[model samples]
Target: MGGTDDNSNVRSVKMVFVTVGTTCFDALVEAVDTQEVKEELLKKGYTHLLIQMGRGSYFPKKSAGGSGCLAVNYFTFSSSIADNLKSASLVISHAGSGSIFETLRLGKPLIVVVNEDLMDNHQSELAEELAERKHLFCAYPQTLRSTIVIMNVDALLPYPPADAKPVAKLINRFLGFPDD
Candidate 1:
């Protein structure tokens, strides 16, 4: 594990995981499914692209399991995406706090795509703040390609790990269970 490898068997797969959470973000799904995005990701040394499409009506038709150079796969939902996030070398996610912070806590490079069609769109504020701090890159569906082209994962600042104790205690009280 410590040695450098020039062989395929010794190399770990570099996967790029995309998630839209439980909301429908078809624009985002469509944006990354394009040939250009896939090629760009390959050029950036990523070996696979996995998308969690959420409840979006649009499903990616291009490359599923059998693709050239870059393998692309997508799904509507999953019981747990913690494993996916942990396995990913890079993450492209919706501007949802859960998705954003989860990836951030994993110390993975992240690109947050904002759903501008949403009514309030307060998620953009959070994305913008994180982007300002150099923790992640922010993009809209239209700018995803350009953002991908220019994104430098090495430049991102690592997000500090979050404390779950307070939240856990609050939930425990609400459920009438003693705090652990």
Candidate 2:
């Protein structure tokens, strides 16, 4: 993703939240903190990037040779992330099912980055399923920045709106209610 292009897109993206859950996801954080990625995001007009840097050892402020553009960005670990979820224009996250479900509940466009190093590639399964359903996009940390740039958030759309009729009917049937 080359830096310097559209102004409207920049104006459109006001806040982007990148979360690695409560685990160490240095790779994903590092990808976003890369000079190239920083420049690309700046060019795209995404000024506010709040990173939930979990247990990662790398600190953006202490990183060497990083552009000052990232200096003003927000970085912290917060367990109660509902506020961030509510405010973010887009969410880029680890492919944890909890995060996926909650983000979808908020109706935000999510990009899932699956960590293959973890035990059992189950998150990959969930990520792939959601990606196929057009509910989210998936990428490895290695390709995260490019994936973000290449995929237009507007086109990706929010998760399909929730429908409760089927669930309600099933619950009522289980309780011995007459079939409608």
Candidate 3:
């Protein structure tokens, strides 16, 4: 409940960017909007929480303003999220291949939250594999709070750029094709 405009003491703002891509993942949107989550993020030294809600029916009731030290804001969509991704210290994204690779290519620490409601949940397969390699952490909506509590950003390995052979090999491996 403490709100202030003075950020002079803050050297550089660390933002936690959450994107759900082009689909609705309300569970994700709602999960990060909670007071408990915000407090946890603040404890981790993050100053902002920005959510790209995409086509979700649920919008967080929280206002787009600074709540204590953490400024929470969200939007429905954007033409290009590259700038947002670039600015983030950490990214919590839906388990979409595009989102996954882009954030990884930026060499940012990422946590991919799998939406378990989808019928053909390929997201889990990709997220789990990436997590297994320690490139990023994977979580479900139910486990996300706990994941945030325990996440050590320094422990994540940088994901190789897409043009790199390792990425090609990873994709091939994910698709069940023999490494060539």
**Candidate 3 to truth, TM:** 0.84
Q: Which lDDT tens digits does candidate 1 get at residues 88-107?
A: 99999998776887788889
Task: Give me the candidate number with maximum TM-score.
Answer: 3
TM-score of each: 0.82, 0.74, 0.84
How well is each residue in 81-116 modelled by candidate 3, as lDDT tens digits? 999999999999999877888899889999999999
Estimate the lDDT of model 3: 0.87
* Candidate rank order under TM-score: 3, 1, 2
**Better candidate number, 2 or 3, judged by lDDT:** 3
| Order of models, best lDDT first | 3, 1, 2
Q: RMSD, model 3, all Cα superposed?
A: 5.3
Off by over 4 Å in 2: 1-13, 62-76, 161-180
Error of 2 at 107 (Å): 1.5
Q: Can you write out model 2's per-residue Cα lDDT over 1-180, one digit (the tens) per residue?
A: 699877644333356788988988888888877778766666666666778888888775432222335333546677598999999877889876668878887888898998878986667887887788777889998887787778766666556546424534554475567668
